[model samples]
Target: MIGNIFLFIFATGALILLNKFLAAWLPKRNPKEKYLSKAETLVFIIFLLIIAVTIESYDVNSSVSVFTIGIMVPRQGKTHRTLIQRLSYPIHEFVLPVYFGYMGFRFSITALTKRYYIGLVIIVILALAGKLIGVICACMYLKIPKKYWLFLPTILSVKGHVGVLLLDANYSKKKWWTTTIHDMMLASLVVTTLVSGVLASFLLKAREKDFAPQKTCLESHDTHEELRVLSCVYGVRHARGTISLISALSGCHGASKPFAALLMHLVPLPKKRKSSELLYHELGDDVHGDDEFGTNDGLEINDSIDSFAKDSKLLIQQVKLVTKMLNMHVEICNATEDLRISIVFLPFHKHQRIDGKTTNDGEIFRQMNRNVLRHAPCSVGIFVDRNITGFQQPHGFDSVQHVAALFFGGPDDREALALCRWLANNTLIHLTIIHFVSEDSQTESPVRNTTTQDNNDVFIEVAGRDQTEHEADRSFLEEFHNRFVTTGQVGFMEKRVSDGPHTLTILREIGEMYSLFVVGKSRGDSPMTVRMKDWEECPELGTVGDFLASSLDVNASVLVVQRQRHSHDNFLDD
Candidate 1:
């Protein structure tokens, strides 16, 4: 009892049409994430059953028929394939276990005697030995590291689910499989799966390294060394802002101070999609040029960044990654360590309206920023936007960027100054250093509190343990002042503030003059700023940045910088 061939064709065609329709209507981030709920899962299963009953020619297995349909359907576009996978996940989650359980029940344990058990064990051992031998020969030919041989075989030994389906199909055909032989094959499959899981756990434990918070910031890096930066953004618009910032950092391309950057654009992976996150060297195009990637994303970003890099005489590597928010921080940290990056620039996870107010807060993206700040392998900066992309290049004297760095004291503040130094190298940027000092404390001669570190690293400590580092503060500012202030491209000023309120007043007075404000996420708690609620709105911005990000009076953007956390992966700060 089966339907006509025409009906089968129509049902299959209908499924493909629906997938195409929804994919075109939805956004790239998958707005239909909840479309296939539990109720819809049953409807999907019922449709599959109807399709399954229509085809009498392939009566051996319904899943095999489904597979035939899957291979026939075209999966050319990445976003198109995303919708297909989203539609198919309900089958994998709810129907797969039931299918396996039904097949498992069909195997009769009472039919197996003690003699069959002995044969099954012998068969399993023989299969395991053969797999190990083949993997060893392949490893030798490939010249893989000896350390990987054990776990490598374990991974290869795990059989795929497709094989189980094929086995059931062959058994139904009554070709070579007897009842005893089929049961033994199923038992061996289960045994090998368990063994591989156990072996992999023990062998890979030593290789698993916990992510410790790092302190790999520019403050510790030698000033003469070539600076390396990893600039990350969420979309094309954000990419534009990063390119402008990188241009500011890429100043004049003098041989005396070289610079390198990697621009990474992140695309969110649709839920339940099994595609591995890919990091390609060039975005939007494979070697063939105009592949199924379809050039829908990042092409504009790549071209703009490439043109700027070429004009500036700097080599910028552009890359894009499709991944879930859960693993983005890990990928960022790993990339930082591999590239030996000095710092990472991240855009804040909010959109700015025309009135200079921030809205449409993306909490998931905010969490991503938090994780990166907590575990980044290098220094991390969150760039707040107030027309950051519209920041005109330093074309001439008339069109210049007014940049200011707020310095209190600490590793992070020093990092902000170091970055400002990079920005000031451009003749078009006017750099201003604003120092906040306590009203009672007087400016005295420098005290000797310099601490030398191994391998050209240095940590500055003031004479007093409880107060901010006054000596280190002056040393860094003096060097910056002597070099740039004389050139008229830089300005140095000090404001005596009694408390946090007074400090806010100073910021309010000077905030309107600057187009960009650079501040550290954390600084020494002096009497002037210790009372400011850094933890109120967003703790990740520290004291000054939190205020600047939320302020409606000032139209300037903010960059909140943090030095890399020290190496303590096992114990992360809450």
Candidate 2:
């Protein structure tokens, strides 16, 4: 009996050592290959098992002999580890239920007598107390997050499959484990497992939103302050294009209060992991890339970003997070609040192909974008790329990059113009301000804040303006024109449109002329976009953004800007 007990302890030590050794091999996998097949994983486990069986004493279970091998594998890069976790998740789901069910079937709960029940109660109390004390000690020893302390004890106390497998393996061989003893062990196992699961569920649910409060928004933000932007992205396909947009935003006329961004590249998380061993996110690296199925261009995405940052005046913090896709928005919102972000830049749900045809990437991604829009604490911009991964400069007398802001007079429009104010700082960037107004519009100072009355960029004088409603619009637009246009750094123009169709026509005609087009996500009750909603496909993009993003042949990319609107909504619950 003493030898048997010693073997159990000895085998456990071996398991730990092997797991550590094997875990170190994780980095050997491709950095871009974030997934592993169940078949492949199973073979790896089997290989470890065989090696462990060869090394360990026959008295200990083979599972126990190779245990440390599970923990000792090669250390993986953040992306590699995250990939395996996500890839191995479904296999865990399938195997866990099957394993647990088989164990449950071996138990005979109804056969226990009053005497056995009394003993069972004692066993359970001892088990709970022992695990709880051990966990409390570990918590004090290791600086684990205090929040996880609420559930880790119970989670660790939950009975595992290995013990049951051992009991069954030596069912008739062990003289100590009589039928009566076996029944009681299985019964106690079920009790502890059920209790642990319930407690963990309750605890985790309560702790889900323990994140800090989010209060910043772009509307009230200071223009002179360095913009703290939380830009969320997925995959490496659009990384360069996203960086290009960030480059444009980094320039300012003065000492340049450029954006200091926390660029988050999100990936799906694994289902199960050791709380102490897991890292939810880590700083992304500047790796190289190639176009292969398992090894894709994702590796090179950060290299481009690194190169860009090295040469540019922008401050960028790259982070990669591994989390559930459904609950990703919660993480984004938390990061926004933690970093006090002023704005969040999101990619459009639909991506434009080389042929100018647009296709919806994924409904899940779209839902995540909506959730972010609903819960984000700051201003948001949905960037729609139309072959603008490289925002090609027009070859002309200008021979420079042209940026256009289509203003329809609203809080969002004002924000778009505010961004344009910074774009004007880049002498290579020629800024054009296009105001879409109705026939009943008036301006006291229409003495042309604009220059070079060219075709399409003409100033139109109108009549019968709404003084009360357009008060803010007129004030902001006039200020923008006076400051930028009067400095001879910007071109200002006004176009009178009868309806949404006419406005859209005018926009499409001049869309490709500029390298980038900026527009407000809302039309601000303007009659110009009243009917545009009838054809609006992506409401998250707003009417104008939807028009440009969904169009089959618009070469210029669009940035749909939305200023934060104050409302009494829950952080994420509402």
The Cα local distance difference test for each model comes to 0.69, 0.67
Residue lDDT tens for model 1, 514-552: 888999888555677767884358888888898888876
Candidate 2 lDDT over 289-360, as tens digits, reads 212221344446554564565466444676776678788988887777778777788887777667656788
Candidate 2 has an lDDT of 0.67
Candidate 2 lowest-lDDT run of ten: 285-294
Q: What is the TM-score of each candidate against the true structure?
A: 0.55, 0.56
Model 2 quality (TM-score): 0.56
Give Cα distance to truth, residue 314, candidate 1, Å: 2.9
Best by lDDT: 1
Q: Where does model 1 exceed 4 Å of error?
A: 1-215, 253-256, 274-295, 388-390, 443-468, 486-489, 568-574
